[model samples]
Target: MKASELAALIGAELNGEDVEISSFSSIENISEGSLVAILGNKIPEDIYSSSAAAFLAKKGADVPAGKTYLFADDAELALVAAVNALYPKKHRDGVNPAAYVADSAIICENVFVDAFAYIGSRAKIGEGTEIHAGAVIGEDVEIGSGCIVYPNATIYDGCRLKDRVIVHSSAVIGGDGFGYYQKHGRNVKIPHIGSVILENDVEIGSGSCVDRGKFDNTVVGEGTKIDNQVQVAHNVKLGKHNILTGQAAIAGSSTTGDYVMIGARAGVSDHVNICSKVMLAAMAGVMSDIDKPGIYAGIPVTSRKGWMREIAYVRDLPNIVKRIKDLEKDKDA
Candidate 1:
């Protein structure tokens, strides 16, 4: 595609002569006729010297002399737009013969069910949805329009996933929650009778599990993105646009407000309420409710400022101990 056309599609301002951009490449591997997105404030000297045809750069970044640049307020968003324009995904619209769809299931127009996929009784699949090979949609489940259920994903009974939701391979939605009661010196299983609701535009990563609630719904709000291997326990309510990174776990009944970010390996205890716009640093452990929106870190998480001070104090512990011993020896003399 022409550089001018790509810039127009991505809403970027083009500077310098328009050139043909065949594909995208990384900084180290960029060749002539390819486009590369420059991220952050610093641009490497080698990138300026590279043979790339044009750069997708942020609005205020300094461009090298004579280099073609396509500038946008958000360089990453522009790059994504460019890539989608260059390589649009092709969708196949027919149901495969090997699929096992129940007679009572309702499949809307333009839906694609791949080979070996199973749609249970009374399930409703909306228009433009794609169920990949080996996906199992349980009884009475409702998946909205334009959704994609990747291979081997299992949506247990009664879960409802809204428009444009993406369930990656091996993700298990609406699974029974880990709940038990002590009865006669034995652990008795507590039934998970509720469902899971994934709101519009949520993307659940591969290997992640969202367990069903005890009575009410386990709701994952609109535009939330969950990373791989994350566990969202029963009755957890995640608000819109929240990001749960890899290995993050939220215990049962925990609720997070909109725009909250829980970093990799972070955990929130049961029944904890995390407020809007809160940011939990990687490996943070939340034991109680967070009423204020702020960046928090460390085990038994605290404010970012407090965590930093604690870290500094711990780093100087050895020197402080040595000084204390010297003072004790002087007192003995």
Candidate 2:
């Protein structure tokens, strides 16, 4: 599309001549006729020589020569919007010929059911929703409009996904959590007798597993984005707009406040409460509640500065031990 049209679609301002952008690509791999994203002045040297026709750049972004720029406050988001506008996803409407949708299920207008998809008894699918190939929506499940259930995703019975939710490929929602009891030397598996509730605009990435609650709902609040391979255990309540990175694990009964940022591989202990605006660093092992909002890191997760200081102290342990030994010898003399 033309640069002016693209800017209009993405709500960005067009700065240069209106050039037709055919496709979208990252800055580094962009070739001729592609639209790339320019986030800042620190463009890689090799990417500066790319043959991209236009760039979706943040306001005040330093644009390389020979590219028409669409200026946005958020370049990455603008680029994503631009890509959606230019390439627009083709959502096939109505039931697919190969899908097995129950006659009792309520499917609204403009709903798309792809080949091999299964909608169980009494399932309710709202308008403009797309259920991709091999997706399984269990009995009594309710999914709102503008939602996308990607290929091979599984939404178990009684689960409720609010509007605009995106469940990526292979994600298993409402799956049984790891709840077992040691009874007379044999482990007894506890039945997961609860459901999952994904509020509006929540996007769960591929391969993520959100276990069904033991009794209450495993709730993910509005606008939260969970990265790929993340594990959200039973009864874990994630507040609005939380950003959970890939491989993050929230143990059962843990609740996090709005705007919380949990980095990749960060683990929150069971029953812990993380306050709003808290930032847990990558690989942080949180064992206790974070009552205040701040940056935390390390195993047993402490303040970043304190953790760094402890690391520095531990690094000097050998020297400190030798000094103590010498002091003892001098004292003996």
Candidate 3:
């Protein structure tokens, strides 16, 4: 695609020759024929030396000379569009013979079911889906079109995976969550009488567990991508396009806003509400509701800047105490 053509497709303004470009990449690692995305105020001094054929820049950004610039109101959106255009999915045709599909199940055309795959009774598999080897789709599960269930994945009964959903290897969707009660000095288990609802374009990474709700549905909104080893507790409502990094855990009934980013190993307590566009740093433990959008850190999870300052003060505490002791001895002498 030409630079001018990409601008038209992404609703951006072109500022040089309509040169043909094929790929998208970051500024620092821009390949020779790729389109690089640069934020408005993030143009590095070395950007002029980049070998990228074209650039995606925020509107009103300073365009470097001798390079083609495509001005977008939002550079991130332009990058997403360009990547999607350049690397559209390529699906396989027909189901594999090794798949063990139940006779009562309904499978659509052009689907790929790999060896040892099991589709349970009354299950509905939509068109263009690819279920890899060793995957088990439970009874009455409804999987939408263009979805991908990777190897060794398990989808429990009555779960609904909407269009374009991707479940990676070893991910256990619609599993019963950890909900137990104490009764007469003994542990009593609560039966999970609910299911999981994964909306369109959601991706569950390998080894992740998305538990079913207690009485309702545990809903993962469209375009959300959960990373490996993450645990999403029952009844959690995750908004669209939220990014959950590796080992992140969301307790039961917690709700996160759209476009939220939870860093690796961050934990959100039950019943907490994190507002839109908020970012939680790695290992941060959130115990309260975050209604404002900003970067957060710490165990109790305060502002990232405040946490940095607190760390600085703690680092200087020993020196300050030694200096104070010396002054006191001199005064007493």
Best by lDDT: 1
Candidate scoring better on TM-score of 1 and 2: 1
Question: Model 2 off-target regions past 4 Å?
Answer: 44-50, 60-67
> Candidate 1 — which residues are off by over 4 angstroms?
none
Q: Which stretches of candidate 3 lie over 4 Å from their true place?
A: 2-4, 13-15, 22-32, 38-52, 64-69, 181-188, 257-259, 271-278, 288-295, 327-333
Q: List the residue pairs that clash in candidate 3.
A: none
lDDT for each residue of candidate 3 in 180-267, tens digit (9 for 90 to 100): 9999999999999899999999999999999999999999999999999999999999999999999999999999999999999999
Residue 309's lDDT within candidate 2 is 96
TM-score of each: 0.96, 0.91, 0.82
What would the per-residue lDDT of candidate 1 be over residues 1-333, giving only the tens digit for each residue?
999999999999999889898889887688778899888656678887788889899998877779899999888889999989878899988899999999999999999999999999999999999999999999999999999999999999999999999999999999999999999999999999999999999999999999999989999999999999999999999999999999999999999999999999999999999999999999999999999999999999999999999999999999999999999999999
Write the residue-wise lDDT of candidate 2 on 136-237 in tens digits: 999999999999999999999999999999999999999998899999999999988989999999999999999999988899999999999999999999
In model 3, what is the error at residue 332, expressed in angstroms? Answer: 4.9
- Compare the candidates by TM-score and give the number of the best one: 1
Each prediction's total of clashing residue pairs, residues at least 3 apart in sequence or on different chains, is: 0, 0, 0
- Prediction 3 TM-score vs. true: 0.82
Q: Report, for every candidate in turn, its global Cα lDDT versus the true structure.
A: 0.96, 0.92, 0.92
Better of 2 and 3 by TM-score: 2
